[model samples]
Target chain A: MLYIKIADLKIRIENKYNYVRALCKDYIIDECEDYDISVSVSDKEIDDEISVAEVAVSRGYAEGVCVYRNICYQLPVKFNSYLLHSALIEYEGKGYAFAAKSGTGKSTHIAIWQRVFGDKVRIINGDKPIVRYLDGEFIAYGTPWCGKEGFAVNDSVPLRALCFIERSPTNSIERIPASDAVLRVFQQILTPRDAATLDALFPLLDKTLMQVPCYLLKCNMDDEAATVAYNGMNNDN
Target chain B: MKIKSGFVVREVAGQTIVVALGEATKIFNGMIRLNETGRIIWDMLSVGSEKADIVRRITEEYDIDEKTVQADVDAFINTLQGANILE
Candidate 1:
């Protein structure tokens, strides 16, 4: 059994298999007894998730089920949070989230910001980050299941802006209405497949949108694009 | 027919929007924005009211004639049906 602390919750992982333990190597901790939630992974458990037992015979499925069981499925519902598909970055101590469809160049755009600001910007999480409402404000938190790039930190910052990014020949930034922002954000977040979780997700999402400002960013992968987006977002606030 | 189970109507920033819930979200894709009258008619649908019931309630709620309310209700139902949101 391994105890990992993320998003202010102590999660206990009772994995009988070595794959999940190795996958969570960076997150392993010692000397923690009380746990907020406990998840277990085994060959039988994976077989139960899929109808064909043959399909569950792999290390990848074992590791994925563990994270999916804990981070993507259970934690969000329990904590009133959403796992947004975006590249989160911290700038000036405030978190900015850049979101788009897969291969829409969210990482490329954030790279431009890093090129321009050079060390002034830090990626909070490259792929999925938890956006939760706490202390009357919305915050972006990092988790162990940072997407393909493996870029995630065990930290959180106050959410400042959410930009729905799209690839364009020319760069432009437009402030969108809250209603439009809510719909766009709903698509970007990892929505649950059940009714109970969906009910919790809606009000939490609405409250987050009410507190944070949203924008639509159209830009190319150029240094000037970052400058334009940065200036437009900063000047407006 | 009845309105889908997972749809929730909400008012945000003075705009009335209908969001799809759970599995319904996969088919709807995005949210549906409704006007004041549309919101009223949608509320009636939520309670399993029929087309005639919607027309009557809409006519009573607004100053419009029954014929106009019927046409509006037909158009709204058509829109919902086209989106495949009605159960």
Candidate 2:
């Protein structure tokens, strides 16, 4: 059993493969008998993940995927946390998340930020980050399941805004109303398969949407895109 | 017409979102976002309301003309029907 801490929850994972352990090394903690939650995947679950995976995956990778999926599935009801499919970054001490459909250049946009802000910008989680509502603030935490870039840190940041990226020839961004943001945000979250968990998620999701500002960023791959995104979110525009 | 079973409706951020779950996933795997009027129509449909009855209810509730209400109701119902969410 490997004990790890993620999104401030202490969890015990019954891992069968070294790959999962190494993937989660940054979040590993000293052995402890007490944990907030425990997870273990059956062979069937690993097989299920492999079958649905976009590419071929080894048993170890599939095991890791199943464990993370199980953790995400439990987080909404167990803790006020859920997995968000976004590239989370910290700029000027506040977390900002760039979300879009797969192959939508979320990582590319954030990379532009890195070039513009230099060391002031840091990737919290390049792909999948856990968003937890803590004490009236929505926080973004890094996990091992970050995308192919392997950019992640064992840290958390208070999220300031979430931006949905869209490709366009012109660079523009605007603060979107909750009515417009909800469905876009919902599509990026790992929505629960059961009604009860989803019921618990709706309120948290609502609160997050109401409290945190959301933006629709229609931008091209230019240095100006990062500056425009930053200025718009900061109300400097 | 009625919404398919296993579809859960929730009001989030003052917007209505219908998500398919369990058996409903076998047909629809994504969520449907509805505006205020669409929500009203959806609620009526959940209870197996008829098309003419839904048109009447919306016209009465919103003080809208019957023709406009009928058109909106028809469009909304057509969308649901195309999505296979209405039975």
Q: Which candidate number would show the highest lDDT if scored against the true structure?
A: 2
Q: Cα lDDT for residue A100, model 2? A: 98
**Could you give candidate 1's per-residue lDDT for residues A1-237 as a string of tens digits?**
777776677788776667666656666677476777777666666666555434435755555555555565665568766778789999999899988888899888988999999998998888888787777888888877766677778889888999899999999998888878876876687655565765677777777777788889999998988888888778877
Against the native complex, each candidate's DockQ, computed on alpha carbons, is 0.30, 0.70
For each candidate in the order shown, give its overall lDDT on alpha carbons: 0.78, 0.91
Q: What is the interface RMSD of each candidate, in Å?
A: 3.4, 1.1
The DockQ for candidate 1, computed on C-alphas, is 0.30
lDDT of 2 by residue, B1-87 (tens): 799898888888988888888888878888888877888888889999889998998899899999999998998898888989888
Off by over 4 Å in 2: B62-74
Candidate 2 lDDT over A56-133, as tens digits, reads: 999999999889988998998989989999999998889999999999899999999999889889998999999999
TM-score of each: 0.79, 0.92
